[model samples]
Target: MSTGFDREQGEFARGARAAVVYPDLGGSSRDADARLEETAGLALAIGIQVEDRLAFRLRQPKPGTLIGSGQVETLAEAVRDQELQLVVFDASLSAVQQRNLEGALGCKVIDRTGLILEIFGERARTAEGRLQVELAHLDYQAGRLVRSWTHLERQRGGFGFLGGPGETQIEADRRLIRDRMARLRKDLEQVSRTRSLHRERRQRAPWPVIALVGYTNAGKSTLFNRLTGSDVMAENLLFATLDPTLRQIALPGIDKAILSDTVGFVSELPTQLVAAFKATLEEVITADLLIHVRDVSHPDSEAQRDDVEAVLADIGVAETTPRIEAWNKIDLLDEERRAALSAETAQRDGVMAVSAATGQGIEALRTMMAQRLTAGHRRFVVRLDPSDGAGAAWLHQHGEVLDHWVEDDAAFYEIRMAAQDHDRFLARQDR
Candidate 1:
């Protein structure tokens, strides 16, 4: 299948003819500005050069264009003047509103969710990632399928029986999309099951799994690459690494552990997206440790952190789960200010300040991560009689054994593992 950009036949080459519009529907103007920044970030990520931007303080949204007929007319002139091929709204649009906006602007109109979905579609590389993106795209389009593909009906081909009845085109298309969605869901389920199997296998390995998560463009990918010494496309753009990537890293004083970098979270993420990306985020939910990487240099860093934590909770990653807050981009601050912030961070539990780009405070951060990750584990050496070798094997399966040496009396095993592993080991000994 062709990528979304390819399907456009190089329409995005001169750069996605684009504009950003937002409704100043109350709240702080600073918030509205931050949202525009986010939309700009999205434009940058999708290779779209934002030609123009329109924002207004609206008393209430119009049902047709979402802003108002007058505003739509003004935006239409801007779209024409800018020769925009796409109008990206900073807010979610209803099906009718999206179609009406396109008709008014004489260009493709996409909501924030749709734009982000397109970005994900183009960036998805792995098979599982592609399938998940397709699933999310289909689910998103399923609701507004009529508005998006209505123009396709005018195309003529020898496509006969596949076309079905002209009058039932909408319903027929809906059924086709629904059927495809069902199949994609099943495939994703298989993908999820396979991932779970891998996780189970990893559980028996000698290392713990650490997941890195945060808001988009918060530098999680950069930090992941910095720690793992592997190139995984650490860009300054949003959603640069859509697929979750993992690498092995040895900590300062602890054994090796698998460090996974998952996709970033965003404020007011569409529910359809959350549902579709569950398979991808399962890596975070099941991780033994979570490293919440925050861009402390961002103006809305605190709000972004809240948004990420909220999404993590919504995704069923228990708040009680152990997490380390990595306040990144400290080098972006002035020396005095950075020092002040670092002192403040020292007062916070399980929090550290670092810079992924400059490699400042990275060693200390890694040591903190390693210590917190293995906080409860204790080392033990156990001997198993010949008759209990099977039970000893079970112990090894459940714990990380640092070494194994055999003696004539018994098989000696040295392990460093969680307290639960020790309990299970003791139970096996009794049996």
Candidate 2:
């Protein structure tokens, strides 16, 4: 969708002209500038034009406004000067703080969580993605529901919310929100079950699955398209690809592998979204291998990697899951720096420096993926009856046939396959 400007007129969209503010409490491992840059990127993702970006150093957060009144007045001056319609706070603002800040700043106020929910709300295209976003939004709004109605005293006579005999307007609204969220949860549960069934079927098959994971706008979709040759909305915007896309690709040694591109992670992603998107994230948790796509050109690439790791840990990715680094966007670097990195990474075991857009080092990356996925395969020997054409074909299709011979009117074959695949082959024989 076209954003931030009207098609008919060249006017800025309402609430699109804004400022991004970060409150530095001196607790975060990252400095203030990086946080502000990310927050501005979040704003720009949804077509918001950031007229001003500011970071304030606070000795302690105020209970009412999160920042000192002096700082609020200064921000208000900037807001009025810049003619901004919205103010985006980089920190999580409580309901009270948000209300007070709006009153003082003389403009609309949104915290980081609210802004992220807005991005997800707009970018979610699939039915399941919309459902998850709605659930997360409701979860966020439920806590901040205000009793601002002049007729809040009006209520029904019968029993209602909280098992009470009557319900206030706010309480009734909360009840409706809760009821909708409950229905969404049940629907999502069905989706999750279906996804689990699909994943189980893929596992029962011989093909391995690789999931691409990293921070938002880390060039994962580009890499996925480069690897699989499928166009799946690779854009420069954050959260460009909200829904997961899976495609079958052939590796050097493997006949087929399932490559999955998943939603990009962000720093301080809303907990509601994490809980809401559990079904979608199952792909990452269950993947046979994870390729972490990193934007090596970004100044905070290391910190971004840490944030991705934090989310992975929060989502319960197993320690046993094999992972490799794909240092992407090297083409953005100068020639000398890119060449040095390429030379440095070529000797590394689990790292590859490449540009997805330029197709540099892509073949080496493919080889590395195939080797990692097949590293744990076991060698096995099987004997089949002469009439068992299907069995022999299965062995050849699902495994690397090291040897084949005919002995005593039976077929003897030596192959390399994953343990689970071997078990499935044996199960077929028993059947």
Candidate 3:
């Protein structure tokens, strides 16, 4: 599960039995069992079967094993009795702790960061996605490489004791990793530049870009597909969508708007990933609006929402950016509870209750999106020269033309246009 521990290529074969362990340190906003359940889902996403799942209560962390000795012994017994090939810990582990835990447990061990990195590596489809994953994996591996090494002996080089091994194998490996990471970053910078160019062109195209963001497996892709009619892969698996997807859709009273379906955010997402995927997530950072599709029926929905908000804040998404909380998956709720939730959401200004699966409240959601996106528009009545086809076309493309007619060989248009577009139109008329 650890990225750098992939020396045995097929050691983590599909369907390998594994146990998930979550350290319940207490005072968490979310339940420990839910964390364990999420870890199991992540393991299953990569075809690993979770044979057992447990949350160990720990008031203090042990440097050697993270959990206490007795807890380690109990976990070891489970691994031995079940013949589990792997155990996943739903907490960040130090390199030393990971090494010692594996030694004590007598099996492969991975922590929350490593498990998430594994999922990102498995689900990354595009070349850019693959590169980002590799960069993050290298960053993680570089930190642990020294502690992961078995041989600490100096490789004798140059004249006897004078040189005393200029560089050890572990150091050499780390240098190589650093060099590879540099190259990947350079490549990603190029990708970022290309994406920037595309983004600039989209801005010039003058279409509003709306981004879909939420916790992993929170029905974002389903809502995106429902909105855009694009067949993006939407499954129940965690991290199902790694690459960002975009499609153009028409909204109520809006001709064209770009909708971006982004990779889902997860709790304790690897910081390495956040840094590496910043280029891709720039779309969300620059989005005109964000639609946070949440699994309202999930037990930890509020905590998950907070997790998503934290990631957005980490990525520097502006608090002023307009957001709509799409309380999704209401179909999973019982009728009475769903009704109460619907009523509550109706009273909230920026919230909507929706079931993307059943097509409920989707139209209302669209209307709300249109209203939010066009909230700054002002009505205008502009007259153009009879031969000014370009001016008429520009107005239609950039604004919602409510009515148009020709009288005295002049075309008059009544439109709802943004303040900036209205200014640009006046400038064009003066030109």
Candidate 4:
């Protein structure tokens, strides 16, 4: 028996033999083979045993199955021959189409959105992460309740003899889901408020914020660990890190910076998740500098870069936000290819070639970051009264005091700081 839920495990059981069906709609820029490989990687990430894979040219989508009847038969035969327990579609499937496919193939069926949700549900660990995942899951499920409980549609007569309207089980279930979603939204608002306050506090501090973003399994966590010297779960799997992590690290010529490792982006990230995790992604939006880490060795590196940028745009990241690209995993390339890439990176203004695993080019990357952070700073000379010890100390603590001296009852000082910091200091003095 194929079981979607495992009672003993307290979670969905993976390891079921599965088959992947990639529907190649025309005009897509992504290479079909690379998309297939990525879908397989997602399957492997969840411990699913992929037994067969096939790609079909989808000239037009079938409303019932999203594929032609002949292709559906072919997939059914493949499932039977491979003895697959699950069938995964690389494209989105409507709830009715999913149900029809499961019935036709005699196995469990899920779409790209469902698979991503399952992976996120399994990987989220923190309270906030879990909450976001649950909210997204509920939102996705609310639309599928009709297919989930088909038997509940058979309505009975009204409770009273007056023949009043009767509520079907599906309607009641949907109402319950809607109510729960409202409560979850309320809770999430509180969480967002708390996070906003924390971000405000960090803004008041002296350190700059640098966020790391990239496609899934793009070695972001690896680069983050190399930079921050913290042991986060840097594994070679898709969506390995779901919760956002922040650590303080010192940059060359800079006292400290807050480096954030965020959840990696994938092509076609679920809309439900995008809405639910807005609070978590606020860090990326508010970052002073963004480090876009790319796995340069991947065959579809360019496509992955585009996908990451698309997600960033969806999250409302301004086009003017300062960003630097780190071409990581140089160690994975051949010497010849590595040298070629090195040359290419040199030609780019804000790009660096680095291998986080080998500590190669990390120093150069750090220097670049420090330079960008301090690029627009200005130097100012101000006179202060010697008795005003607090103002003098504040300037020393907040900005780089280039030189200081006291002449009679007056104190002469020079300081270098970012333009914004200087304005903030002046505002503070006025108060």
lDDT of 3 by residue, 10-126 (tens): 133456678999999888888888888899998888767899998899989998888999999999999999988788899999989987887887777878887787778767878
The TM-score values for the models, in the order shown, are: 0.84, 0.89, 0.91, 0.89
After superposing candidate 4 on the true structure, give the runs of residues whose Cα lies further than 4 Å from its correct spot.
1-12, 147-172, 384-393, 403-413, 428-431
**Which 10-residue span in candidate 2 carries the lowest summed lDDT?**
156-165
- Give one digit per residue, the lDDT tens place, for model 2 in 195-224: 989988986775688999999999999999
What candidate 2 gets wrong by more than 4 Å, as runs, is 1-15, 147-172
Per-residue lDDT of 277-395 in model 4, one digit per residue for the tens? 99999999999899999999999899889989999999999988889999999999999999999899889888999998999999999999988887777898877778888988778
User: How accurate locally is residue 50 in candidate 3, as Cα lDDT from 0 to 100?
Assistant: 92
Each model's lDDT comes to 0.78, 0.83, 0.85, 0.82
RMSD (CA, Å), candidate 4 to true, equals: 7.1
Query: What lDDT score goes with residue 298 in model 3?
Result: 95
In terms of lDDT, which candidate is stronger, 2 or 4? 2
The TM-score-based order of candidates, best leading, equals 3, 2, 4, 1
Q: Candidate 1 on 120-172: residue-level lDDT in tens? A: 76677787877777677777777775432421232321111111123123333
What is the number of backbone collisions in each predicted candidate, taken in the order shown?
A: 0, 0, 0, 0
| Clash pairs for candidate 4 | none
Work out how many backbone clashes candidate 4 has.
0
The window of 10 residues in a row where model 1 has the poorest summed lDDT is 156-165
List candidate 3 segments past 4 Å from native.
Answer: 1-10, 146-172, 405-409
